[model samples]
Target: MENMHIVFWLLKDISWCMIWKPLGVAMIFPTLIISIVIAWRTRQFMSELCHNVAISVWISANSYWMISEFFHFDEHHIWGGITYKHLALIPFITGLLILMYFYLWWQPRNKEETEIIEA
Candidate 1:
């Protein structure tokens, strides 16, 4: 029946608002702590701090989206508008790039130590 379908859809919507949204917010804390530890260990303090801050901003945006989606808030008015969902990708990509840069270019070279030893 049409009524049954409507009820199912409404339940789905409510569950999305209540459960999944809060879960998204809860996920950010571990991410931030992990980022900070990794950054400190690598000695890229500034870049690590910047990247971690950027990730926090990104997580806040996600939390906003979760709140907005749950409350059925206005898509156009909120800070994390429906369109802003794509903003989550920015932090992820940025973090990946930072990691890659550290691994590929920023890591200290053993070659210099070897040359000094030979000299």
Candidate 2:
């Protein structure tokens, strides 16, 4: 399933790079769905959950950016100097903050708990 997820992700990216609007837009569903499923399945493992969630967030941002470009609104500033493409940063930063929380706070504080759970 993970490998298939990767395949969908790559197809999405390849479609984006080629400016294939239909394929790119269509690929978003499977890519995002698979990532969500993976995240749900790994909910019991903090590390996997965090990583999978980040991947899902990333795919959302990527798809949004691709759509913005496909429809030719990517560079039109919505506020100040920020374009539609820049909105993707919201999810991008969210994913980063999630990883930071996991690595800097949750993981450290729960190390023993996780280890015991795994054992």
Candidate 3:
């Protein structure tokens, strides 16, 4: 399943690079769905859950960025200085924050739990 997800992700990126709008757009669904499923399946383990969820969010950000470029609005400013492409930063930062929380706070406080899970 993970391998298939990678295949879909690569296809999505390749399509984006080639400017194949329809295929790129279509690829988002499977890429995102697989990420979500992976996250859900790993939800019992905090570390895996955090990493998987972060991956899911990263894919979302990537997909949105691709779509923005496909639509030719990636450079159009939506705020004072922020462009539509910059909106992708929302999910990108969110994924980073999730990982930060896991590494900086949750994991530190739950060392025993992680160790037990690893066993």
* The best candidate in terms of lDDT: 3
lDDT of 3 by residue, 1-119 (tens): 99999999999999999999999999999999999999999999999999999999999999999999999999999889999999999999999999999999999999999999989
* lDDT per residue (tens digit) for residues 92-111 in model 1: 66656765664466445444
Model 2 residue 109 lDDT? 92
lDDT of 2: 0.93
Q: Candidate 3: where are CA atoms >4 Å away?
A: none
Task: Give candidate 1's error at residue 50 in angstroms.
Answer: 11
For each candidate in the order shown, give its overall lDDT on alpha carbons: 0.50, 0.93, 0.97
Can you list the residue pairs that collide in candidate 1?
A: none
* lDDT at position 44, candidate 3: 91
The window of 10 residues in a row where model 3 has the poorest summed lDDT is 75-84
Summed backbone clashes in each candidate are 0, 0, 0
Per-residue alpha-carbon lDDT of candidate 2 for residues 1-119, written as tens digits (9 for 90 to 100): 99999999999999999999899999999999999999999998888899899989999998999999999999999999989899999999999998998889898999997788668
Pairs that clash in candidate 3: none
Candidate 1 error regions (>4 Å):
1-27, 30-38, 41-82, 108-119
Error of 3 at 45 (Å): 0.2
